[model samples]
Target: MDQNLKIELGKQGVFVTTIQELYNWGRRSSVWPMQFGLACCAIEMIATTMARYDLARFGAEVFRPSPRQADLMIVSGTVTKKMAPQVVRLYNQMAEPRYVIAMGACAISGGPFKQGYNVLKGIDRYIPVDVHIPGCPPRPEALLQAFIALQKKIDCQPLTGAERPRFLDAGAQGEFPVPVPGGHDLEPTSNRGVWPVPITMNRGE
Candidate 1:
């Protein structure tokens, strides 16, 4: 729709919008994030919801305790190898159009714990991450920025055609596999469908 035309219509007390636009508008306006936190970053995540930051302005302040009722997952903190399965399981339980925001350095790349044998290098190995906020323990403002970014992402998603989000595509995988603990580490290491194992080419010595 043309901007000028929309304004003209508004002057006449008329409104115009398509089903796709309306649907996207509703989804972006009410993204309920799952109330799950992993480490220190969770503190900042909590602060983001407080009066100072007021995350409610973006319509994401209501954190759902159950995965089934949430559309967004803000992975805040370090994910340990032992807890990887539980995180993936919760993600699988979320309904279609689900999104994830990898918050803080730990959740994105394990931060200072990246070398720890128990810390999972990154949560992206098990599930798709829609946005990543880089910081040791990102302040509440950083989280709000990431939230807005996620909202913009949701708003731009097409309802149909090749550009449509995976959830809308009937053939796309509905659930991600939950990793299990093996003797040495999480079985399979990563979800190839989500984050493919990096291939390193070698030259003969």
Candidate 2:
């Protein structure tokens, strides 16, 4: 081959390799989460990203405070009617390929607050949702599992077909399923005027 032709082929090879690497990187880092913590479920959401569960193991630990920089928003608690507009604004601010995970029964379908006049029955009434984590306060593991489910859905999403899989299905029937890890059944912890022990961050001061 001529010297000039060889050099041109080498440059083209380098360009193709760089583009391929960038494409892979983008896919790996596609889901950037906006940390929109609202109530109890927020603690579980933080735990998922913390040292124990470590959401970073799956490339989803990037928790951006600004919606403009995020592609996923984990709505981690009850969204009241008063806050509906703000939620919509935040969802709109996110870049394309955005996703929302309603990270509690409250966010998914108002949880125990479904009868409240002030609380929004479901987040889907306003903005689109991608995953729904069912629990009054779901465990960190469950949230991480939901993240993985979200990733799978994103991967299998059709480019030109109908929109992505929606987490909430208003037409679906029955109560949200509660996940019981370690084969433990959920038992009510309190009785009338009896308070349960507060969850401590550490054992002692």
Candidate 3:
């Protein structure tokens, strides 16, 4: 059974896995999540990572404080108009092949907060949501399930997953744009390029 169970490095004994396999394995094994928890659901997310739940077992325990180091984002609560821009910015900063888990009903569909004029209907409105855990404030067990689902989704994706990650996917062709607080509501920033701002005021100069 040892023959079938273990890998054989034929001669030098120094040989092991290939570079790409090793790289991919490291990525698949250690999914560092960005530090982002918004509302009541954030508490549940913390519990899921604590002793009893131990999200570390699935290789996603290292919750990074910096978006630059993270590849996974668990949007664990409500997304209001004011917070939507910040959320999308974080998503933009994350590396390619990044995954998002819309945890709890608020992050998924705004839950009870949906009726509030300030609440964003869904996080999907700003960034692509990979998994959605449906509950007003989903339980720790439910968050664990979301991780499993995310792992499965990651496994199915190509190694070089996203095509032209930052710019192209941000949808220059009129899709979701980073939101900004303007007047009484949020305004999309994609059209700012076309705003008639003077390159240089010449006549008086």
**Which candidate has the highest lDDT of all?**
1
Model 2 lDDT on a 0 to 1 scale: 0.69
Better of 1 and 2 by lDDT: 1
Write model 1 residue lDDT over 1-205, tens digit each, in one string. 8989999999999998878889999999999999999999999999999999999999998999999899999999999998889999999999888999999998998899988999998899889999999999999999999999998998888999999999999999888889899998888788889886666612320
Cα-based lDDT for every prediction: 0.91, 0.69, 0.76
After superposition, which runs of candidate 3 have C-alpha atoms over 4 Å from their true positions?
1-24, 160-176, 189-205
| Model 3 whole-model lDDT (C-alpha atoms) | 0.76
Best by TM-score: 1
Candidate 1 regions with alpha-carbon error over 4 angstroms = 201-205
Please provide TM-scores, in order, for all candidate models, with all chains considered together: 0.94, 0.66, 0.73
Cα distance off (Å), candidate 2, residue 176: 26
